[model samples]
Target: MGGGQQYPTTCFNTVIKTVVLAGLLAQKPFKHIAGFTNSLLKCYAPDLHTFYSETMDHIHRWNPNLRCNFSATVSVFAAATFNFRPQTITFPHLDFANLAWGWCAITALGDFDPNKGGHLILWDLKLIICFPPGSMILIPSALICHSNTSIGSHEKRFSFTQYTPAGIFQFVDNRFKSEKEVNSTEMSAEERAARVEARKIRWAEGLKMYRKCPSALP
Candidate 1:
């Protein structure tokens, strides 16, 4: 007797996107959403609804490296919405403080490999929480951080992060000085290589952000 074949992989792309976009729309400004939608349409091609509803579905089913787990998928869309917010919104003493929030979401076409593409890593801190696929991760944006691991050959990485007003305030690297501001000149080749190596090791060991909402901040 013939037997039925098993499924190759689960399709979670659409579910994740729907959840993230819903969450973003609930909080973000309407003008920001419109601008984001326009950019998204151009990037995905065939327009917003078509890309999200149809093309995304088709690619997730057939494309190899383009697919991602549920959490990664949702986090990316959430980040995208957050990143697309208008610049008119005022913040306290900071220049575009989006990166301050440690909470970020990313999707890789395939497995997490450091040598090939960017991977998630907690900067200047250790992992406090890790939300694998199917698990939700909510954290104080300033307390947590993540980086993208490398993607496989010919694959793409899509990701973004969210930050509340305070998280932005906390993450601002006040000590950071641009070349124009600093007296120092160029760096040695050896120093550049060392920085690259240091970055590699940083991403190799994964870290998590602690859970805390903006309302709880002191």
Candidate 2:
């Protein structure tokens, strides 16, 4: 999803988003959630856990107020955004605004036949995953093309999503400067080159964090 896309803002959406965020950030299950998320990272994209943890920690430390504006309370990652989807099939799309190497956490909710409906389609991965209620998946949304198959008309399907945007981290690292502001700054050729080199190194280091592990998900 684009960062600028208008999310549903009705009371129901607000309440559900709040409840899910609260659970992720405060409930006892949060520990399990963190473990499960890390386990998934270890299995599917092992290089990302450190980058994810460090980015989240940085946001929490220096940008504690940076959170989803749509959410009523603090979210799990300070730079993360919250989205709620219910009973609707999402069209195939890349979450381009999210960090390309960072994981997006999605928790499925509501009653539905896993074999028949609410299947997550990872087009790039060539997998159709049966997403049952109360289960979660962590994926690099910006790097994967994904969508969902329709549910039966009588069935219910809901999902809560949490993602951190690359721009947010960039802003934090740039001392809270917006891209435009950063671009407008006058810098010596050496300074600009140094900055670019630093970014390249950071990106490479982030990718190196992933190590191949046995696949855990079917």
Which candidate ranks first by TM-score, i.e. highest?
A: 2
Tell me the lDDT of candidate 2.
Answer: 0.66
Best model per lDDT: 2
Please give the clash total of every predicted structure, in order.
15, 3
| TM-score result, candidate 1 | 0.25
C-alpha RMSD between model 2 and the true structure: 5.9
Q: Which stretches of model 2 miss by more than 4 angstroms?
A: 1-35, 42-47, 63-76, 79-86, 199-203, 212-218
Model 1 superposed RMSD (Cα): 20.8
* lDDT tens digits by residue: candidate 1, 5-65: 1222222338887687656545534334334433433343322223233323443444346
Weakest ten-residue segment in model 1 by summed lDDT: 1-10
TM per candidate comes to: 0.25, 0.71
